[model samples]
Target: MTPRPGRADGCPAAAGQVPGPQAGDAPYARLDTEEFTATPHAVFEALRAEAAAVPVVVRGGIHAWLITRYDEARAVLADDRMAKDVRHWRDFHAGLVPFTGDVAVAARRNILSSDPPDHTRLREVLLSAFSPRRIELLRAQIARIAGDLLDRIAPRGRADLVAEFALPIPMTVICELFGVPADDRPGIRTWTEALFHGAAMERMAQASNEIDALLARVVEIRRADPGDDFTSALIVACDAGRISSEELASLLRAMLAGGNETTANLIGNAISALLQHPEALKLAVGEPRRWPQVIDEVLRWDAPIQNSLWRFATEDVEIGGRLIRRGDAVIVALSCANRDERAFAHAAAFDIARADRGHVSFGRGRHYCVGATLARLEAQIALPALFERLPDLRPAPGAALRYRQSTMSRGLISLPVQFAATPGRPAATCAS
Candidate 1:
């Protein structure tokens, strides 16, 4: 459905209303600093304490409204007045701020950047390719992939989970699912990493170019010799005039990024949480079923993606008493929303058993992450298997946990842990 052109509420962006965030210094917090990236909770707490919606600066020196409270976040996400297309971003259109993704790629319809019928069509096609039945069938393969990864690292008493475990498993699974050739995956991985970690516009745009180029090559290969894979299915849709060639390529790129980056960081975040909270870890390990709850808490506690990309105001709209001008960018701070004291009791604390599992980690409504099920499935299978396979697994002594600095993402750069050294078991074998 198309976003509503304007808010019906009496709260209008009248001249008397305070204007949205300006380019210069703001009275409230600026979220673009590295300090915020490293330790953002305090800032979030203060921002939430102040108001539901606060004007803040993000990366690229862009000024926008950050939705901090849980209720406000849900409202803003579901509110029809908020639009997803970057063309609605006032600063980007005015050339005041750099664009977020590949202009060429975004010109073609993709889930991350498109709105309306294009987004609807692309999402339906994606659902067909990533059906529940297909995800269920891949469960065994995901487990085996996790087992293979742990097997390589179990021999060493200590391992960097981010490298050996967290990152590779998801990358491998997504690549296999898409039928992406092994040789092409390295570039894909590199380009995806750049998209998440790149601080400058040039680098992110460059990565987008590289990803589109590689995806174009892959599309040509899949079209020539089709297979029973996601890419092949999408190619079929493209051939039938259901979607454009650029849409197919752009969607493949979306899968490559979302399937791996989000999942990889999620696995990393879960492990870090478990190690820090022995009580939760013990309960999860003691009872296998609780792994889901534990993973759920981790999603709330430290979401893989901290803040959602910009959702622009289709017209002047009031969000939680603040008047947002037409075209002003708004970001849903999932991290803050999850830990909102108003939403959860002792919200700052991480309690796996906490009854409220309804955090916006995967977002809400139609724009919710399409890969949520797959991410949960991967974490649930991989997490338990790791603890069961490694004895006395704990963080490396004196190894300070470092997080990659990104305004939009919150994930451990590396999770160093030690466990009892043992003779590694042979990895499980499965059919192609």
Candidate 2:
């Protein structure tokens, strides 16, 4: 099946129409700023209060239209007029828009950056590798990974969950899944972190270069001694002319970044939510079946990723009373839409028991995260394993929660937690 139109896969490669150097300023502008990231609800509420589609500035002062209401957001996501490819954007082609080296590289050919026949072709191949059944099969391995992570920090009464647990688990899992050499993973992790956290163009370029260099080496290794892994499969595809070398590298970049970064944030966000709500934590701990519901609520209440990357307008179109000119960028505020009062009752409240929680955390329609099932599976296996090991876990007292300053991804830079100290448990054989 083809990817649904307009959905995001957690990659930041889309851009827009506003031409003014600085038409929008402060408060509403630059959603990546710490102030805006801290409490986006107020800003989104104001936007929703004003109109369904509102223009705003994002990182680097780029202007785009933001969709706040749920129905409007869904419509814009499913609308083919809102194109995923940034090349179609008028401002981008006019050279008014500037993409950093890494973003530009991603925009060239990644599945997250393509549309139509190209997007379908790219997605179908990767989907076969990341199918639901394949993801489900990794549950035991995911649990073991989680258990090992928790074991490492068990002796310490307090640990930065983000560093100790959240970040490494998915990074390790994705690397193992792709058959990336253990020695190369550290460099890959470093580069991936830089690409995500590097706000400046120069640093982003540096990180992108490092990643490309490493991927090139990995490609050679696969060519010399192929293995039964994604990297090898991609290489085989490359040899078969199913895809070009550049496209293979781009796909590898998308798979690594999209698969790992988003899952890491999802785990972090879910744990942070549970730490904040004791009753919810109790429910999760008392009833294993409730963990799925709890996770769904967490996905809705505090989405791992917030705004979708930019989607360029394929043509001049009117949406939600706003006349979006052809080539303008449209950003779906997934976080805001999840909490829209019109779409959800008591939208602001976080209740894990709520049955009607259908938030578009993984996105909606076609371009929905191809790794959505994998992300969910990782979280499902990881969170319970963590809680089961550290039942008394709670946020470290007086330790301020600091989130990474990012518009595309929502995550804590450091999630410090305190739990009862305990001896390390022997590696219990995980279920088959």
Candidate 3:
């Protein structure tokens, strides 16, 4: 396809000479600072009601486009003209540091940041390990982990759901998958948290270094005594000349971060949503089969990953009446897209029974989350088990639920809940 021409306003003019929103336009320029921090549904509604493609100017006068309309957002996400590689940007070299640094590096490790052939190759390699059959085998293990955690916290009468249950469950699973030692789980968790939440570049650098060091150790261990784990499998692939060490490291890092943190946050967010809607919890508890629907609603209501990492425009492209210029950075608001009224009726309403649970929570196209099935399985098993075991589960009185201050993952830091204890079952016995 021939590349579209750039507009006079520096936006990409659509084919057939359609003009996008002009620069300095009030509707396009209005900044919603709260959208960055507010409930995703609220942000979605605001953007839908305002304009289609809003021109958002951030710090240092950097101009990026925000697509709020569902169709437009989907088009942008799937469009071949849009580039996920930051190197395509005019500021490619300048953005390299941030891209490799903590926050961006964490986001970029996955195939989400690559374009075409590279994205296809990287995704194909990882998808082989994360196939549905492989993830299904992990289900029994996940259920046992969830049950074990519940056994520990059930007697406490009151427990922080996030810390006690949600965070540890998926972390354990990811560790097992990666062949990380049980004793080293805490360090990995701390490192991930620090890397995700680190504010300064130095802190991020330190966290990155620590993560690299840990992965190096893991690689060395697998080299000496490889096992039937993803790490070992990756090492084998590298040795067989199927992939380079750098590619192996990137894939492993991506798997660790993507599988661990996102799934944990998804569980935490789902639990919080269930706590807020007791009816939904009751339905899920009574009908375990309804877990699929319940989890979908939870994902739609409170997505774990907020905005997709950044996609730079490869060439001029017009979307939703906005002409985006070549090299422009576009942030696709997945959280916003989930609640778009055009795609979902009564979008803001948290109805688990809603037939249209369409959401971009796992993203779309070639970069969709590889571990999505595993994440869904973990949530399905954990949520029903929690509600079934503790039917009266509710947030503790006067306890304040605090969300983590992050643009990437949206989840509660702590969710204190009070519920009556049920007869205990060994973690291993509870899965069946």
Candidate 4:
């Protein structure tokens, strides 16, 4: 049943739940550094060595404790005391958060920002669309999409995988799944990128508003003429009083925007990781059975989502011997936790052969990514298809690798590559 005492705002006043307003501490770490984008694990490693959690300043002057260690990160992600509701954030209550009204709605209305029973209800209805059988049924379509992408780039002998293939596959699949029109998908992708990545931070507010307006329109259309789409299902739930109208719109954005970025990054990251490690690439490309292991190592070594969303304490709690007071927000450094030596041996090294392939990349407990299965299915299909078609994929010489600017999401802005343009489908790289 209900595990902890809730506040007047309906947030749990449990262990991770933050207490009322109190004096705050100066931030000890800044997540906006260039180093974070280039080498985030280094930052996480430094912080973990100091403590499990340390006070940090995120962008927009949001002060919170960054959870670096694996044990603390896992605990805080699942701890009932660490609530997701933005109202539990003391900074928001004090008008210290810089979010505008529209931006504020985006921050607080989604499932990521909600706690039970609202989170419970929203997640229950949302997860129905991502069920195992439904995802498996999509396997053929995902494979077709991957093959079609390769066809377009195979003859070029050179390509920016991120722009040409990796980005479009998930963006296309997810948008179509949600009933988003083909013509409108490109604009939505642009807006979503600007909202999540820091390089385009100047347009963050504009992008948020545009995305919201578009999602609202989608919700309105589904309400009148229902279709075979997840958005339509969410509309029915809204009408059935299963979730609020606000949540319906937010979930649509969450699903569309969140699904696209995570999978896109996963594909790009997997390709890059495999290319860097020739032996691993040989195993992944030459040995079809080990694709799953290759995908797991890429996820753990360089998670698509770096420092993910925030969690606030509804009340005071102690983590790693540090007393985190109520109202203090916490960001779990997923990238750091996955590489934590305490959790996995030789965590720093990217080892595909490691038997302990577990990681918190998609998160844990109640907030675990609903699209985890879909993401995996897409990557499992994408990787083998690319290497099989190209067979000799390798990084373009002198092209420097660059990641997107957002501290929250870790993904390549561009992934340049050179490959052989064979006449027919290249012979299978993996054994049949």
For model 3, the superposed segments whose C-alpha errors exceed 4 Å read 1-22, 27-35, 57-63, 91-103, 106-110, 422-432
Ranking by lDDT: 1, 4, 2, 3
lDDT of 2 by residue, 1-432 (tens): 222112122234334423422123323344646677787777778888877877676765556788889998888888888888877766566555556433463366688888878888777777766656656667777888888777789888889999899888889888877778888888776766766664467766777788899899888888898876678878877788877888889889888887777888999999998888988889888989988888788888888888887788877777777777877778899998999988888988889888667788887777888887778888888888888888888888898877877767788889989999988776554322
- The alpha-carbon lDDT assigned to residue 148 of candidate 2 equals 78
lDDT tens readout by residue for model 3, 1-432: 222234323554334442222334343442324454445556556776776676653322234577777777787777888777767655434332232232265244456567768778777777765666767778889878888888888877778888889889989999898888777677777767865553466665666677778888888988899877788888877887767787888787777777778888888888888878878777777777788998898788788877666677778887766677877667677777788888899887888889776688887787778888888989888888787777778889998767765655677778988988665776457656
Q: Which residue ranges in model 4 land beyond 4 Å of their true spot?
A: 1-27, 100-106, 199-202, 220-225, 424-432
Clashing pairs in 1: none
User: Candidate 1: RMSD over Cα atoms?
Assistant: 6.0
Model 2 TM: 0.90
Indicate the residue-level lDDT of 396 in model 1: 93
- Off-target runs (Cα >4 Å) in candidate 2 are 1-32, 100-106, 427-432
* Model 1 residue-pair collision total: 0
Query: What are the candidates' C-alpha RMSDs?
Result: 6.0, 6.1, 5.8, 6.8
Looking at model 1, residue 40 earns an lDDT score of 88
Tens digits of per-residue lDDT, candidate 1, 1-432, equal: 222211212233333333335423335467767788778888888888877888776654556789999999999988878888878876555545545433322333578878877888889999998889888888998988888777788888999999999999889888888888888888887887777775366776677778778888787888898887889999888888888887888788888888888899899999998898999899998988899898889899999988887788998887777777898878899999999988899888889889866899888887889899999999999999899989599999998978887778788889989999877674334232
Query: Could you tell me every candidate's TM-score relative to the true structure?
Result: 0.91, 0.90, 0.87, 0.88
Clashing pairs in 3: 12-323, 12-324
Task: Please tell me which predicted candidate would have the highest TM-score against the true structure.
Answer: 1
